[model samples]
Target: MTTDCSSVAYFSMEIALDPALPTYSGGLGVLAGDMLRAAADLGVSMVGIALVQRKGYFDQHLDDLGNQSESPTAWEPEKVVEPMLPVVTVRIEGRDVRVRAWRFLIKGLGGHVVPVYLLDTALPENSPWEQKLTDSLYGGDAHYRLCQEMVLGLGGVAILPELGHSLISSYHMNEGHSALLTLGLLEERLEGRALSSATEEDIHAIRAKCVFTTHTPVPAGQDQFPHDLVSRVLGEERTAALEVTGACPAGSLNMTYLALFGSRYINGVAMQHGEVSRGMFPNYPIRAITNGVHAVTWMSPAFGDLFDRHIPEWRHDNLYLRYAIGIGTSEIREAHVQAKRRMVAELKQRTGVQLDEKVLTIGFARRAATYKRADLIFRNLDRLRWIATHCGPIQIVFGGKAHPSDVGGKDLIRRIFESAAALKDVIKVVYIENYDWRVAPLLYAGADLWLNTPQRPQEASGTSGMKAALNGVPSFSVMDGWWVEGCLEGITGWAIGHGPESPDDEVFEIAALYDKLEMIILPMFYGRPTAYAEVMRSAIAINGSFFNTQRMLSQYLANAYFRPAVA
Candidate 1:
């Protein structure tokens, strides 16, 4: 609403604009937010749209033994966001649900501001159930989910014009959750033409204005609704429209298929993910634009100050970070020491856990999903104990939240707690409770090394390691997601498990992790400090420079937003 001249609109289920605002759940929202910030930095005419989740993704609470519990983590819209004027209605379950929106401004490089509109449906004008439709994110049953998506996709399109975004030439759907925006686009393209008369040309026109990015690599992760449910939420006419647009197949409404059918340019988060997605969909041309973090936002004060002194242009042009290769290795060490000190101080204050700053600390934190294999490092406790005993003094910092419904993910956290208990005296292992955007930076910059152990091909494009790279923290991760592209062996960071196709064996992956930690990573950190610093320097010079949202948005600008379709 702040920018009436915007020509591009990016839609996602959630966006991470502020730490106080819990609208985002995890990586998807974080990536979405980073793109918008980079759009501002690049001075692009872009506006962001997402549902304003009232309860957010819930406040993750972990008990002493790592047992997880959840509660509604609500934030008042009026407090953090400014109310906008446009109030629209989205038809759900044969009733008109009133919807409103709020505005949040994201300040990017050189103080350029990008506006993000958060859609809200908690109006008093609607029914009690309708009022609570946007109350919680990822809450309720299938019906509730369909209703929320309706509010997000359908309602988002309707409000854009009222906010003076009618000239929005491109619609970039971050994922399938907002694929219904294509349906909204189809209706808008009609331009008073009868809905029944909508043809392939109309759908083609809609495709030209739309782009989609599929983030979910697993089948169960995609959203789908039965025809009965689809018919109930969306009337028969819209359901029929979906068929005409090929947005819905005969069996059920698959959100991913709808997005694929409606998009002109489709992409996966990483090259490997793109290959996997193409195999799954088979028909669509799904390309890969690897994910990245906001350089300025994710960079820690220590590294940020260092970059300011050495590479002043790094903030404006993230690619300038490649010049960080010239920065003295000792300076990298000095900054990392300050970052680790800050993290150690905070850890002691919050959890009463005092970790030695000199100890080799490895950070592993993100959404606790089964594919991530968060406990893979603890597979052989004796091997790990021997590594600490012979290799060097080591500590591990763990933090992340599992969805309330993911029983396996919750169980993984408990296993980590048990592993920590088993190795308490040998390694100072700690799991921070209620991990969020605020706690992420400390781990990224503070750790001596970043660790990721995702199951083969499941990771779409992990950005946390990229964020760590910006702060000169080298990754020791499984060769999946962005790591496949970013890993330069010992130059950027170490690798665990081989390539995506090597083997899906867990024992092999664990051995790779333990072997590297014991034989490679720990020894280098303890014995060859200067050599380790050089690795960190390359991580920033190479991975950090290229793996940033500024570069990501520039790619989107050329490939999606201002492409031939718009011309």
Candidate 2:
């Protein structure tokens, strides 16, 4: 409630606090939520700021042919969060647009608490159009998008002091969407001084209190506004200041560049992504801090109970999961069987498709983007069929939502449905609709193997597989993103390809994927149950123990949040 109460303020366009909220579409928002959850668990002095999407990301629907359509995901936020008294305004289309907030409290495992403020523009005092600016996540055209970012970045900064976070030691930009907050901080630095009169000391002073993290290498992931559009929304003075600061080097307002130029500490989400980012902006000293999942949230109830019985300390210290190696393989198998039974039962109840706990189940759930290649395994149905029929009986489950504007992503879902029909004779496939936070743990705990295939260098960091590992599910993926650091080759999980950013030799990768399943993974899964269980146990001990937000939060606290100020 006061400035000293929270020393660090985190800003993001979206934050996935709960499944019922539906404010988030995918990984980025979910990661933002996890960071705050971890911060609460560690009792870190931090406050979170994000937009309150009134209609939500979108509710996903798929036709029999896999044609995807979307509708607004509706919910009553009043049921969960309390409205704050603070109201702030930002200039939108040369008019004053008022912004308010809703507060949601997150409680940690240790009973500590963290407060998250969701910025909203749906106030009665605002115009009809202004009221809906924050109504949808990633909605609207160029003008609407720029205006929404203004509410998030400018209104966010203005309201923090109103809510009593003026003593904030650091302003963290979760991604480029919040980059404009730097300009707000710059305004504070200028005081009454003109932009041209601001000295290097003034710029460095603001940079000293800011930190930023870039999430992806994909061009679509970064936000950039053309010079003309920038002038209309942000006005000439801020635009001139941006041009002078080298933040608009590409002759456009590149959000990533603005944050990078404004912050003293900047990082990419993964080690490989950091290298790619360094190349993308060769002059900047970018560092890598691989992303991770929240261990307690991801671990299956059965597995949670299993750990509770053996390693009681694991609930407090995720590193205690290393003691999981000492846990009996039979106990591990029993716990997995319990979780698998629940998963099988749920599938039957929801989709009317009966599943067997004994059957080998492979799952791939992600945003149905073209680059993700969700239909990659279906690239060669003949090979997959032969492997399933000859080596073992296998079933695959798929789920995710495509961005409303992404035609390729929608086509990808349809393609997977087509592939399912073609392989219905040999392999049973089911595509779950409207996948959300509530559904993730089911597939992770029950699936025999977790699968990921992203176009090389595009996946900044994959937290889903790390989640699967917590439930004792091993990943079968390409050597990219965090997988490069997590993969121990058959120990923690198996790799699909041999190298990083390997050529798009689809045939080669497909052959390799099938060969491993037909020759090694399937045989061990069906014939050598005991040995295969060892792999599951190892996934929990090695990958699950380390790839958690607890470890991730520690990295940020020591390296970014409290980094020593340069002389």
Candidate 3:
């Protein structure tokens, strides 16, 4: 079945369609990109709206002293890293903002005409700071971040009408950043009408055509600002026009809350996350629409060719499995080893570090946030030393970035860095600076085992593990996010946490789990070669069928989009 919806506009703060586009920071962006790619492949008529930055996010550079330094990024037209398309100008907030939106005319992808519109705030007329808005994927200052989101949400709402495209069949808010678009639509409906005449029915109709998807279960990531503060940033009249909750602390309206109240359909990224989200937003009815990745775009082409040849059943039924099957067992294992060796070599060349290849190589890469427990391995220095020095030596390769203004997260990075320097060789820890979309594929493709020790329930849908699993790398993670669904007991990976909550008694549980891992997990990895291979094989087989973009998109069509349409 093919879809011919007039148009579906997808809104997000980032996109990871290609590694060359450093506009993505982590999983959320990558998922957004996968959605667009899959939509194009499925012919699910849609257009993606995203911010086009000047710098397109931070450029990480290590100082001579090995300290990370970040500054305002200026993107040259020639180095924009995207193909050109005719731009369209729109009036957003009383200003003529020129945005460079692109139309992707995909072939053999069925009916969907996917056009991704990139809004540029870097026009000649824009202020210097405004021009710099597009510099990094996640830019500076709380105010600047709010301003960027405003442009994304409110300004984005104005773009469609201004572009003379009125047949918006549906609006999909990828995350909270796009919630304000719903508000803009509300304002448009009540342009000349009085508040007394605006009924809940009116609000329902506006939201009926919209769907909001939440990616993170963590509170901090959902976006909460003092209502008065946000009102000051966005005029009171406009705020009132949108019907944002004024009951929040300090009159603040949480963007996620607004998204929940403003949209007819709301979803979380994973099954467990969905359950947690329903509880998180107790007042509303939230549901789950687990995220997935596009197979053709991410899988190695050789793997695709292989799947089409051998696994014909999986080829059509499970998009990810079809591609993964292409990778012969030997070929996958050898590629993983080679990628890790190369990554280790690259780290040595870049950071002036050296180490033996025999050491158990463990990878930990993600945003330098506290809940992620990026410093879990260093929980017990002495035990870690014994494991590294006495038992088979273990080496950790770390890479990630904190928002430029997140002092706490940055301090965490520094703390981890110091710990790495102390460990030196036996437990060698090397952080590859400037983490972005480009660096992500390398980390996932190279690591022997992906280590994710986030405080349970904090992680939404950690797709990095999926990427790593695809390359035949086993995972060592907490029992949260997508891992809960992907992990097979003693097969695909290991889990530390029992579930989402880390009770007071189990505060040291992950730490204890790692200790066990140091003694048992590390040894099992080295001693049981055949078992390890089987585990790796199982992970790809399981996740390749379950956690794929095509499957997720198909479900979405049958359950969310098409079901609603037929009803």
Candidate 4:
């Protein structure tokens, strides 16, 4: 599929494009990076705008005591992205704000230039309040976060005009974080005209040009600032202009509200999430566009090579991606086992994480959020003991960081750490600190089984589990998010959330998940470790065929953007 609208500008508060690019921290960042890569590969003109942090996010370090610590790291613009260019200046509230935006090259990836422009608030012209906008992701106080979102939304909208680009293209808001772009666009339309003089058609047309994609189903996951707080940040003039029917609410500007009202198209990240979103916002119209990963970025050379041979044209056809299954060949299977063995050995030595290469290793990692149920395994201490004592040893390695100021999230991290320390040796738990892309490949390549259990419909689309599957690591996940579509029972991995709609309604969902863990997971690890290893190999082969980013990107092109062009 192709589109006539060749250029697209994607606005997001954060994009986990790559480690070299510190604008993103987790899932949203990964998704943004995937979009950037897809735009390049598909030859779709695209630009990414993100904040330039003087403090390029916090390096979350876990102290020896298992408490999480934060350290600020800054990236040199010249060193971060090659060939730094001229700085662009934009006016924000009667002030000339100088922002340095840079372009990055994704090497080894042969594709069109997908320019990623970052706004640096560290410049001399930036006010202290403006500079504060580039603070850490999911960090600082609530009011501070709103200011940062404004920089991303309003400042980001002004970026294109500053770059000399015409406002004829569509913008994809990754989430509510970039909703301000819509307001900014509306403000541009006003152009000294009185609000009463503006036509409804003009407002609707401005909205039609914007699309909002919501990634979180959980209410708490969504950003909701106090109405009074928004007025404080954006000021009366701008805030009044944004109010519905010209009456500004004392409450914060609902990012979701702005996105919904300002966008002609709104979508959720996964099918379930779409349904959840529709239910969550019954008054608003929204559809689902499931999130996906980038096959090129995720596929390991060893595993990806299989597809290069089976589908020789995949190399040339940037969209051609097979999940990279090494089946019907004993040699390839052995190679996979050896790779897993090597990864485990290295992790065991480096992180001082004790593990049996013979014991089935499970990998669980993500942001330390309570809704994600990072501490699910610990919910059943007795079950853990059973696995440790009677069952062949099973180990789970966890890693991720909480927002610096998220005290609850910090406590969750501490809980996981304590559990890890308690279940030493037999049921070892290694929570790696300072997780970055450099170490991510190791986790994906190393795990025997990738475990994901978010509350049903809570997970948007877990690409981390998908990444593991590409590497031949089977998964055990709740029937939520992308897993609802990805799980191939008794084959790739196990699925939970089967018993009831609510995991809280009946203890059954938890029971089922644990039952599968104890009965299926434990046995595989202990009963016939070698045979289970074969299951891992087969699981990757199966998933690699279907869920690879190539297929996902193609779907988005056909269903979302390109189809409209073809029509």
Question: Which tens-of-lDDT digit does each residue in 1-567 have in candidate 2?
Answer: 434468889998889898789778888888889989988888888899998899999999888899989999877777779998988889866889999999998899888888899998888999999999988999998788888989888898889989887888899999889888888887877875777777888888888888999986876778888899999988888789888767776678888888988899988888888988898888788888899888888889999999999999997889999989888889989999998898888878878888767889998998889888889899888888888889999999998999999999999999999999999988889898998888888998989899998888788888899999998899999878899899999899899877775566666777888889999999999899888899999999999998898899899888888895342
lDDT of each: 0.89, 0.87, 0.69, 0.70
Looking at model 4, the pairs that clash are: 15-29, 16-29, 226-252, 227-250, 227-251, 227-252, 228-250, 228-251, 323-544
Off by over 4 Å in 2: 1-4, 501-504, 565-567
Give the alpha carbon lDDT tens digit for every residue of 1-567 in model 3: 112334677889987656665556677888888877777776676777787665766766665334667865454544543444434443334445555443333332555456665666676767676665556666566666667777787677766655545677678898888787876677668886754466887788777878888887878776766555566676656667544343244466677877877777778888889988988878766778777766555554333455566565553356446345445666556655666676667777766877556656788888887788788778677777777776576778888877766777777787787787777755777788777665566666666788988777778888778777765677888888888788776778887757555453245664666665766677777887656766666767777667777788777666655445321
Q: Give the distance in Å from residue 388's predicted Cα in candidate 3 to where it truly belongs.
A: 2.3
Where model 1 places Cα greater than 4 Å from the true spot, the runs are 1-3, 191-194, 565-567
Residue 504 lDDT, candidate 3, scale 0-100? 31
Candidate 1 residue lDDT tens string, 519-542: 888888989999999999999999
Residues forming the 10-long window of minimal summed lDDT in candidate 2: 498-507
* Root-mean-square deviation of candidate 1: 1.6
Q: Model 1: how far is 17 from its true place, Å?
A: 0.4
**Which residue window of length 10 is worst by lDDT in model 1?**
558-567
The TM-score that candidate 4 achieves is 0.90
